[model samples]
Target: MTNEFSNSENLFPAYNQHEVVEKLETGFKKLNDKFINLLEENQRIKQHNKNLQEENQDILRINLELNEKNQEISRNNLESNKKYQEISRNNSNLIRINNDLKVKLQARDKQIEKLQNDLNLEKQKNKEIQRLEVISQNLEKNLKILEVDEIDINTINVFKENNEQTNCNINKNPTTALNYSKGLDDIRIVVGLDFGVTYSGFAYCHVIDENMHTNDNWPWGVTGQFRTNTVLRYDDEFNNVLYWGARALKNRKQNSEPVKLFNLYLGDLPDNLKPKLPIDYKKAITDYLREIGMFIKEKICHLDGFDYFEDVLLVLTIPAEYSEMDKVIMRQCVYNADLIKDRDSEKLQFTTESKATALNCTFMFVDCGKYTTNLTTRKLVRNDPLHIDKVTVQIRDFYGSRLINEEFIKFLRERLGTCTIDLLKENNYEGLQYMVKKFYRRITRSFTGDDKKFNYELDILYEAPILLRHVSEEIKEIMGEIIEIKYNDIKKMFDPIVDRIIRLIHIQLLNNKENCSTIFLTGDFCVSKYLQNRIKEEFSHQVNNISVPALPEVAVVRGAVIYGLSTILYGTEFDGLKLVISSRLLKFTYGIQYNWKSSDDLTHNGKNCKFKTLVKRDTEITPDQTFSFNFKPGSKQISESFAIYYTQKYNIWYCDEPGVKRLGILNIDLSDVQLDSRSINFGLTFGQYEIIASARNERNRQEHMATFCYPDDDF
Candidate 1:
């Protein structure tokens, strides 16, 4: 039984071992599956990690490339900086070079200055040699010849020029700042004129003394030169932009003065005798007029910059007897002067120069101008009428200035030679200038009682006293005759006429006829002493605008400026020029039975002839042409008439006469005359013609003749 039980246990144990083995196999199978899954997951993780590593490696390679490129770029930048440093160094060197160049230039300038000094010394030496050569050459020329008039004059002039040049050169060290060129600034000048038929007085006064100056002509930017005459001279070298009026008149003698007496020829100028340039009566007058315009422009420099001339007032004066044609010439001066500023010249008011003094000091004006005596009546209102008849206007044939001139001429003649007149005629006016200066002081002391010294040189004032005297006398004679004759004749023969004239004035002023509100009287002949009393008596009750300005001689000039402005700016009426026809004879059988001569036209014919006017005293002429009517000086056998006329287009008179026309007097007929042959015009006129009879010495029967410019017919 034990063997059997042990065998059973062994079997049981074998079975248990088999059961455990089977269980263990199941567990192993499960664990193996789990292990396989785990292995697969780990393999996937390993793959991801490998891929990440590859991507990282790629990024590292890219970064490495970028680093290499950056290093290369850095190297290139370093090279660029080195190059930049080189360029900057070059620039610095260039700046240094520029500064060195400036220093070199300064050194060169000093060297040049030294060279210039050396050259100047050499030039001086050369000039000395040249002067020595010139002296050697001129040894024969400068030989002392006999004192012939022209030779002596030339020697004196040469010596004077040499002395002046030497003086100028020596005095060039430090010249005083003169007014001639004051810091390149503009100048102001005031020129007062007192014009007359014979002698024209002038004064240059200053209003604003803005600066100090040494030149009298441009003293304080003002220049005044005057004498009792109209003479002119010029030298482009020294007096290129300079001008003088009275100074020129003073140098009329010794033939060295550049002046002439054209006063008489003013009314009778030759048709083709107009001078172009250099010097002549027309040019002299024109230049003086332009200077006057310049002076006016300078005076008003404050109004404008004076770069280009702006507004300028040019004053001119004329006598009461100035013909219409004369007025035309006077106006031309202004018009031509406009060319200076590339503008049209204009005239201002035309009043009597004498009235200026009266205006300054008195309520009335009584002046004795060269040609006539004039009186101005006033009541303060500008629109008042001036009674022409109430005033006693007088004229005479003599004047103080003219007498002085005559006396000076006599002195020169006695002191000088027979060729004195000829020398003066040869455009030599230095002598006259000297004489005028010397005589100017004397005359001023004698006439005006002013013994003040004039601004002039002694030698320059006494050279051509005779020539100056001639011109002076001429002016005085013409102007004096008018004043003296008017005074004498009005008191003697025209007392009844004066009464009639007064009554006419009474009618014109008292009635205030023809819509006339103002009566203004102006002229060189508006200040007669006799006329003053008459005007005071007649116009004492009437309204008048009597104007007397500061510059009496320039009254007419100022008036002309006003007229010009009115005409240019507005549509204003102006009286045209009036032509004057002096007395001329076409017939003269009334004086005497005289012998015939081939030389004289009146006596050329052998028979005792009776003459008549071919034109019958009616004629008209244009402004462009002159009317030349035939006439004869008073003689034993010739007859005469007075005739002349002026067209409306030539009207330039500034008178306010309603019925008083600008009439032209004509004595003879004008046949078909040639004037350029391109156009033809003709006309006729006659008024109040007169006929008279007279006899010469030792003749019984009164000669038969006619003398009148007006026709008897009222029609």
Candidate 2:
């Protein structure tokens, strides 16, 4: 069967084999289709996965944008919070200020009430005085009715003397009779400021107390010292004041420079002689005055019933040689510093340093200041109010005590080489100042002319090692060693200044018309023992009474207070009881350039700029005296300007003269005056420190006043 089957199988096997091959091929084709399907599914799944990745990236970007927006919002909120906090702080400050103002107002109310009560009391006193006058009048009438024989002789004489005294008192006190009608009664306190070149001081006096009080408690000053250094230190740019007064001299800031001797700029100084200032001289002075004014206000405003504007009178002492323009500048500076209310404020008054010093006593005052020395001789005209008259012309010289300090500096420059001194000055200026202070304190103040008695040694090399490398070996050796300042070395410095002062005093005495009974040594330099001894030695024979008042350094300041008080009190009810400086000699001849008209002739002179004299130089003039000139303006003229000129010369014919300088122009407004009566009376009242020019229209009584200020070119 297997064979046959095999044969059949062979035939069948051939068909079967063909069938098996067909089946195999079909199976392989099925597997290939399955593989193709799987490949297509995998491709679709990969496309879906890529789409999911893109969606995730979009979500992540949206989240990042949201976070960035949130951060920006947070920053805006923080900035708003800061601005709100600043506003809140400002509100708090405003509330505090409001509270302070309320308290000040309440205090002012109390002061007003107190002043009202005083006014009432003064009125009652006036009524009582009137009653006493009536009773005295009745007694006089009864006495006149009685016969001489009936009345006792001694009683009659006593009654007559009493009547005469009452009459004299009534005649002298006209303002008192008027019951305080004048504004002089408003003065409560007077403060005097002596702003010296090297030192400054202030003195205050109450009108009621009439007792002088000086401020010795200056910042960084000795306990008993009345004056402080007039030095100021400014920042590098000079826009701000870093330090002032004694503190300025002690500051060691490397970038700051000290400004002193600025007071000299207020005088008629040559351009070369003026000090080099980083800032404007006026600004420097104004800053200094502002500080001092604040100190004064603080000191005086604390007193009961004291009003700075209404009750206080500030008397500022100036150099005698200061021109009217200089005085005006000082006044303007004072106004700018808030010391006075305005430019024309009467609260601020000026007096010469010499005049102020002379008010202390009738003597030859030798005020030896730092930069200038002034010699003035005054005669005691009346002792009741302590009236003094200037006898000799005031003399001012540059040979002051600072020259001694300069000589001492020169001595140091010689002892230590110039290079070493310059190096020290450049590198360590404070150290140099310290050395000078030490020299002044240890040697200069106590040194007498006698070398045998004085033995002092100054250590100039103690701070020199730091600068040794920059200097030469010779300078190094000199700086490394201490130098001995013997009495001769000091005497050499003192003799030049002291001898010049002595010569000035001698010349002053010779020129003085009145006998210089007493020679007063005043000012900061007057504190020097050597200066005092030398002055005494030189002038003891000429002046029998040579004296230095207690606290002589503050003499000018203290006398300034007296002067302010006396000026206000003089010619009033308090005339005989208070010190009064009644008269002063004019320093320059004041005149106006105008066309002189003759009363006899109707023709006008061709001379248009003729110099008409008003007040001559060296003429003794009282403060109340006025020289008046009548002027008739043209009918069409609306204003008339008078050109006032001044000169040291006795006589000048023309305004264009060499020595004649234009003081100022006084303009009189004639618009209000009647056309028929255009005559104006122009008057000039020369005071101790200023000239007041006034123009009055006779028809309308319209007056205009101005103070004489020299032209800018004169300065």
Candidate 3:
């Protein structure tokens, strides 16, 4: 049983094993199926999740789109509100503007009404003025011309002067004026008359130029100019014209008879003298000017610019001693040329002969017309002339016009026989002077005492004085007998003028300072040695003088040239030249220092020993001049170059003082020069010299240079 049981157990065990195996397999299969199902469920769940996510995304997108639409609607509402607000504001502004405009319109209308009323009032006033003008015209129609003539006009001439300010408004250029076709085209001319107390000299200048308006084909200015001095004598109811100028000097025998109109007696009337009508002295002057004006218009205005000079500039020379009243008349007569500003012409500049001679401007001039005796001076230099810069103190009585007359008288008296001067000693003193002057004019040839020429023998000179004495005796026989008269009256007549001049000089020396100052003489009178001696003898230690020789006569004119040069070359270095004292021609030079004129007054770095100076004070000098001198090491010349000083008009003028009428100064400053280099060059001018000279050694220098000078033309 055990075996069979064991077998059955074995089989059972097998079956059991098999059954177990099957169960095991089945369990495994069940586990596998569950895992597969679980995986499939998980996949399905994932699919569901994906679907839900997609659906949520769609809902979120739709919600966002709805939000965007709402925002757009809100934005539209805001925009509408803003538009309405803007429209309201604009309406308010427009209303305010309209109110303001309404007010302005009302104000403007009122102003317009007022203006119209004022304009009407002005129109009414103008009408009233016109009515008054018409009444004035009616009243004038019955008035007479007063039979006015030159005599009456000249008598009241002082009141008629136009001293009003000269018109200065100017334009760049103007159109040409209308051509004149009036009367005869011939130009006329008249010479001026200068009546001196002792002698009457007439100077004639061309009143008109024959070819003034003629085509500028030829450059010959004028064929020639004529000048003469008329000295006539009576000859049995006839008057004979004596020689004029050189001719008068050469012919002496034929002019010895006395006549009536001899001397220049302004207030007296001569028995034999007659004019077309009764005239006073002043009347004659005007008549002469009038005649001259007419002549100028006729003969000079034919040319374009030729007449411009004559009509605008009427230059006349009067004695410096002319009364103030006479000056007024002369000024008026000059304007009588109708020399107002030309509507179509440039303004004319008035000037003197001295100014013309300088040639500072390109202006035509008439010179060599009338001449007066030239003054000469030696400039008496004393140690001190008071204390102040008594610049113009005439230190001495000089050889003047009176002296020339005296010399002439003395010469004639010594040669009375051959010159026939005794025939002039008539009862009337004026008549005597007249007759003598007439004869003396042509007496240049009366030196006919068989004068010996070319005596080279020195011994002959000793005998010459004896020969001269014999000649004098012979001359006395040829002339008529002379009757001497009291000379006291003649002396008395001239004493007052001489004394007055002396008084003026006396006053000049009374500066009253006990300082070392010099009287710098700057006029024509400084050239005379007699004047120098006079000042030394009279004023002595009170006055010192500085003279410029020939320059003083025309210093002002040369200064005018300097001024013109400066005017044209303003701001350029071409205006002036400077110099340093190279070598010593003199030591311890004496100079009169001017107060507050140079670097001392205006410059920052100033000195006490130096001052500025210029050369054109008509101090005598030469053309193309060069020189040298020494100043003490500390002494001063001109620190800031005073070579040329400029001016606005005719900066300076030269005047002649034939008698005792010389005085004045020249102006100079530093604006006229510029430094050309670090080293300076100087043109040294000293004393009154025809030529300036310098040398390294005055001891070795044998020859002194000389230069000849002519008179200056004042413009």
Candidate 4:
């Protein structure tokens, strides 16, 4: 208290002082405790402040990362928007292209419809022309008959003046009629006419000389050429002939188109296979034959001691696949051409091209023509006169060198547009022909499948400049003034045809029972070095020899002359000097429909309309073989008719089978036979060229000979 009241007393003051010191110590201790507590609390507050600062730093970093992610998402959205816009533009372009295509397709459809209409109109016009042609033919035939009668009178008069013995002989044998001329029985000259689809030629042989002569002197006067183009041209009305052969091919007029490949119509082909013709095919054939016949006649007349009416024998080479009706039509055409006086004249004989080619050699005959490839296998029977027998059925295919040209045309249509080609054909036919001719002459004949050595360029614009106007921009960009024909391009065209020919040869060899050691190639296409090499390479192991005869292009025509000589001089002094076809393998089974209820028949199963086979398929039949059959005449029947049918089947009971075909009808006169006669004997003789039917009465011994009647029989 006042420290004790200033000294209230010294003794009391000393005690107060000690008490004050203790109080001061107690206060100081309390203050020190408070200071330590305050210090500890200040340390905790500093730690808390440091933790808060770290949390604020983490929050700031997380916000910055989130902002970067938002910016990346914005960039992706902008890219997606750009892609969608680009797709929309592409869709617009596609729609425009589709519309343009639709327009072009409509235009093409319209063009096709117009072409169809034109074709129908052309068909109608063709029908009218055919009718007119028939009428014209009949009139021409009547004129020919009158001319023949006049010629017959003149011939008789000449015979009476030249040789009285000939007249006496003719009078003694009334059956000889006006044909009893001095040289009528002797064939001094034989002419072989090879009427091919692409080429035509004639070869003449003198019987005494035994040497063949081919007519190489054509209108163009080209040497070493025995064949001419089978091309013809008519006037604007198609009623008169304008040009023929090479001349027709050279002449390019706007009035009329050239007619080619008419020889294909001579076969009995399906309607789909037949081509459209500007004129009647028969007339076309007749006209062509007439032109050739005139040349032949003029040439023959120039020969010494040659008479066309008596000494000339024309042997026409026909396709092996021709039917009897086709043969008949050909014969009629030949007669109409004035090659022979009568349609049934023996002066004109028909033989297959394959058979004629086979007769020319002992090995297999392969004729690779422009339109067809014919194969025939023959075995050597006698080598002295070169007699050969048919070993296998003939094979004919439409694969030929012409197909190569077709493929080339397709190539052109592809390279340049089809419309461009069509326009060229329509505007400049000659130019189109020139282009094809150039390709055929330069490229097709020279390509050897060697790619490195092959470098050829065809001048397209020079030949057909008009095509430039019609070609598309794309075509122009690809092909300019010239078109390059590579080795692969040509090889692709040749391989298909070559493969087919090889396959045909292989099948023929496999079917042949005899070992085919040698192969003989003939015809124009055989001249191809590529074809020869391929055949050699393909059959090197199997075949021993492959020989291409000299002048193989004329082999068929020359062989035809030899065949004519052989057949006409058979069993004579000149027979040994010529090649003979001894036997032929029948392609079909020939039979006559007859009742099987015969009295002497033991194996009759009571079958009606049975097929009595006379010659079976694949059976080798000789020229002189005759099949005999006997049938009793009905009591009241004065005449009988037999139906002849042919089939490729072996076991056949009826005539109406799927493969059976009615060949012809045979008529027999039984009026001379008595009703009481047991049976009337009938005989059928099959010749290489014709068939003869004979009927004889068993009691009266009266014989009547007849021939099978064809469809369009004029004789």
lDDT of each: 0.39, 0.73, 0.33, 0.72
For 561-620, candidate 2 gives per-residue lDDT tens digits of 988888677632321222235886776788887865555332224445778889888888
Number of backbone-clashing residue pairs for each candidate, in the order shown: 110, 2, 51, 0
Q: Model 1: what TM-score?
A: 0.33
Q: Report the Cα lDDT for candidate 4.
A: 0.72
1 or 4, greater by lDDT: 4
Question: 450, model 2: CA deviation in Å?
Answer: 3.5
TM-scores for all candidates: the values are: 0.33, 0.55, 0.27, 0.54
lDDT of 1 by residue, 597-680 (tens): 345455213443222222322233222222222222333322222222222222222222122232222111111122122211
Best by lDDT: 2
Better of 2 and 4 by lDDT: 2
Misplaced by over 4 Å in model 1 are: 1-229, 236-243, 246-255, 262-265, 269-281, 303-310, 313-315, 318-400, 409-715
Worst 10 residues of 3 by lDDT: 164-173
Deviation (Å) of 325 in candidate 3: 4.3
Clashes of 1: 110
Per-residue accuracy of model 4 over 1-715 as CA lDDT, tens digit each: 8777665776657658789889999999999999999999999899988888898888888888988988888888898889888888988898899889988987896687557556644654464454444445555654555566356676555544434543444435423312213333588899999999888999998888888898899865756678988988998888888888878866476656798888778774545556788987888999999998998889887858677978888889987667766786787788788889875565877777776777766454577877777776666777566677543434456557888788888998888878878887877787777677667766645766545558668777667767677777786665565788777788887887787778667755654445777899998778777788889998879989998878788877887898888766652222122223588776777778886555655343554667788777788778758888888877776666677787878767777668888865545444433447557776667754556555555554434343443222211
- Report the lDDT of model 1 for residue 598: 40
